[model samples]
Target: PALHRQRHQFVIDFVKQHKPKKVVDLGCSECSLLKKLRFHREIELLVGLDVNGAKVKKHMYGLAPISTDYLQPTYDQLCIELYQGSVTQEDARLRGFDLVTAIELIEHLTLADVGLFSAVLFGYMTPVAVIVSTPNSEFNPLLPGLRGFRHSDHKFEWTRAEFRSWALKVCLDYGYEVAFTGVGQAPQGQQESVGFCSQIGVFHRIGGRNGCNMLLDDDADDVFSYTLLYSIKY
Candidate 1:
């Protein structure tokens, strides 16, 4: 899971550089990244969205435990919200966040669904910055015994060129500037040719809204949306 840790660190570092006050994580399954981010007291609001109702419920009811010491009242003061929703669908309820993230989640969706997801993330929510990470199909051959994509649920994985092409198109369509990077170390002999185990795309919105005006509907469909704002150990 070196790639997992590296992806997490990349996201953490990105957040540090941007210093956003409001943030949203698009595919926050267990809120693990949210837990790590809560340690930063400067973040005023943190929202997590996922497609699975059970996972959202677990995070809300405190069933999903986080590994961090219970301390710091300042951390308790930060707001943490969780919702169950699909990235492919447009939900006007989540708009105006300063930072939005979709780490290691795009490959789970089909190519067509990815288009819809891109529209939702870039057009609807429209955060100041967005971060995404996905498996680099080019590196699969370097992994021992790995014959196919990294995960069974992943519909398709893209090579570095493919990923860059798609990401560049999105940036152009959304009026955002983007940069590419990678996670994990390259294989020994292939270090000069093959890059990292995972690829990342960072997008910064151009002349976009900068406020944190996200509002959640209390009566929103129970199956689609749920909100929780509280603090807990990392």
Candidate 2:
């Protein structure tokens, strides 16, 4: 549980350092991270997308400002919304955001879906920066009595070497730079080999041509598939 919080903290630290205005959380299951990001004045627009529309609708209300928020409002105006959609599909509404996050989501997807997700996220939506985290299979051995994958829904897990290789390939294909980091260090004596329990990949777009300037065609811009569930403007 502590490590889980650390994974979210890693992302929060990124937002603090970069201060992106428009941010979206891909695969935002319960809007937990969105709830945290809502407190940051730096973000102007916050969006959350999940394939489980019902789940998103149920928990998204937690992101709304509380009574005290109305009394002591100091943050900048914020517009937050939730969407029901798949990450693999292209959504015109989601393109060109400053940041895109997919924490602990890739392993749940099949290998084919992962390819489509990469093309859509890196090649199409093209956020300025993307943060992704997944369970480190190498650390699985240290976990007592843990069997195959960390989660039953997870289709596959990757070792540190495998994840690094895949992240580098995405950078090469999509014209980006990537840095690797993780949380939950391994125990004594095994720390050198196992590394972090949750590995993270931070990808930043290279050069000036990004999602903002790349949107030119009217037909492509008309593509909107995700259903808008709820929105709040403050």
Candidate 3:
């Protein structure tokens, strides 16, 4: 309930914040964000994907038209487009959108697929923004007996430092500029799992710094946050 409500709010707020022409929500479970985006009068398109078809069906009552193994467009912006697929392995064919989002994704994929996954994702961008998130490695409950952090399906999580280092490389390798980065929210009094990252990244495409690999700008914000980074990279 809280997750869906928050997702709805996030979509509403994000649409207002960026006013993107097109948006993609990778690893979108049940299209919560996409469904919430329905009220955005300015949104021209919304696409969502999930690795599991059952989850997609559970979330989307009418998305049965998308019968392909991966994706088949279901609707225009006014009618949320949902797909059953994997962000890590599925083709990131969404090209040149004003925004692309991967909420609670990344850590679910094998570490080996991280780079290729990102590369595929970055390939379709038309010099715009990307919003991505994953679990923090410091607090993942995957340890035995739930001693610390644990997740049933997580492949790998990254610490703040680890996330930053990878983020820096992602910017350089993919021609994006970092604008902001931070952690996601946690319940009051309950320490949030940093080891189980709930990170967010916002990026935009740009040229390298005089022919060298483009590094995250020093001005990039690693400011105060709670379960979401709101990082803006170009």
Candidate 4:
């Protein structure tokens, strides 16, 4: 649970540093991270997408601005939205965002779906930066009574070397460079050997920002597969 908080904080710190106006969270079940992100004054547009429409709809109202928000308005406007869809599908609304995050989400998909996700996010959406976090299989042995992957739904968890190898190939296929870091240190003696409980990859596009030009594009070919569930403008 502490590591989960750290994952959110890690993205928050990134927003503070980069001040990305448009951000989206892929596989944002329950909209928890989106709720946390709504408070940042720098973000103009915040979007969350998940395949489970009912789950997202159930918690999305909590993201609405409170009475205090209306009484004491900020200078910048924030448009928050939730959508129901698979991450492997391309949506016109998601393209060209300043930041994209997939927190503890990749491991849930099968290997084939993972390939589709890479192509959709890195190739189609092409955000300026992307943050992805997944459990480190190497650390599973340390958890008491834990047998297989952390979640029963997780198709496959990658060991440190396996994760790095996949990330490196993603960077190469897409024009981005990646840096690896993580939260949840191992026990003092085994820290060096097991690495973090959750591993993260931060990716930045190469060649002077390739996706900005299409930020406001209205091309007919652009697709909108995700169903809009809720939206609020402030």
Candidate 5:
């Protein structure tokens, strides 16, 4: 399943609002997000980094068919670059894209390295905006003793508050004001519920010289009106 699809409106709103020239999808597995932006050719460059470069190269040929459908003209012709490198140690200097997304990738990192990882991203790229989504620890049934996300690799899952605290502290240390938001909106939903609710956070880097200043303070702006099991923005 493509997570980018789950948050398509956010991406559209984010793009139409910010209009970043370059984009980097960190921990990008199949570069699914890049394929979706095929219609917007003027976005300039796209660089995707993962820990396994060979994996990206292999998928390029495998996804060739998927591209022909919507992401036509092929990525090689679209000026998209995919490489295998860890978001934790990846050199984003030349990869300083307008927007960066690490959806569902945060919980895979060690609790201590996450903040450091974000710092590394800012230190080199300093993108005007960033989007991060992780499983809200409050809902992580495997946490406290079961390990993070029930993944053999994930180091930790973060509560809404914990995610935002890390977001604020990291950006502040790097000289930027940050605004957070839930990824999956519920404002227009028909009813309120928990098992059906999802969590996410958007971190906008302020005064960076590019990207738009987008913030959402409407507490009722979620996928539901009032869900006791879900959490508030941090």
Candidate 6:
């Protein structure tokens, strides 16, 4: 879970740096990052989207709530909206957020679906900034006893080179500038060469048509049903 902690901190730092007023988190299972962002009063609107309605329902209704120990008494005071939906589909509800994030999420999607998801995220939703993180396939070999992919659900993992190639293409197509970084440590000698255990890409829209007006050109079907889990406004 060290990798997750690293990613969480990395994103938290990103939020601090940008000080976005509105933010959306893709693949926001259990709203872990949302809980962390609650401490920052600058963020006035927080929305979380996930494909799993059941899980969102559980979290919102307290059947499987996120921890509140790090939360202030008024933490629940801010109404965090939750949506059950796929990131690869067009939704009028997701527009105008200043920031969007997908932490360790892309690998769970098929390569073709990855393209669709990209189109939806960059092409349509068109947030001012987007952050994505995924497993660095090249680093898998360095971990003791770990084999194959890092997780059973990952459809395909990408090496650092592969990830950069794809990320560059997305930026070029979407008129965004992107920067790459990593999470977790590499072996002492391999630190500079092999990079980190997780790869991250942050995209900033410079100029281009807002993707909401552009159609998602990929063929992958939208598998998730959009359901309102909860909408609380403080």
The order by descending lDDT is: 4, 2, 6, 1, 3, 5
Clashing pairs in 1: none
lDDT by residue (tens digit), candidate 6, 124-215: 77888989999988888898899888889999889889999999999889778899998888868987788889999988887533544544
**How far in Å is the alpha carbon of 146 misplaced in model 6?**
1.2
* Alpha-carbon deviation at 210 in model 4, angstroms: 3.6
Per model, how many backbone clashes are there? 0, 0, 36, 0, 5, 2
For residues 62-159, write the lDDT of model 4, one tens digit per residue. 99888788775554888998999999898888988899999999999999999999999988888999999999988999999998778999999998
Error of 4 at 155 (Å): 0.1
Ranking by TM-score: 4, 2, 6, 1, 5, 3
Candidate number with greatest TM-score: 4
Instruction: Quote the positional error of residue 68 for candidate 2 in Å.
Output: 2.1
RMSD of each: 4.5, 1.7, 11.4, 1.6, 12.8, 5.1
Span of 10 residues, lowest total lDDT, candidate 5: 225-234
RMSD of 1: 4.5
Query: Could you estimate the TM-score for every candidate?
Result: 0.83, 0.94, 0.68, 0.96, 0.69, 0.85
Best by lDDT: 4
What do the candidate models score in CA lDDT, each in turn?
0.77, 0.89, 0.58, 0.90, 0.58, 0.80
Runs in model 5 deviating more than 4 A are: 1-4, 62-77, 90-95, 140-150, 184-198, 210-234
Candidate 3 Cα errors over 4 Å, as ranges: 1-11, 62-79, 89-93, 125-127, 139-148, 183-197, 207-234
Residue 186's lDDT within candidate 4 is 93
Worst 10 residues of 4 by lDDT: 207-216
Whole-model lDDT for model 2 versus the true structure?
Answer: 0.89
Writing each residue's lDDT as its tens digit, candidate 1 over 84-149 gives 778887665566678898999999999999999988888667789999999888888889999777
Evaluated against the true structure, the overall lDDT of model 4 is 0.90
Tell how far residue 62 is off in model 1, in angstroms. Answer: 5.1
Candidate closer to the true structure by TM-score (higher is better), 4 or 5: 4
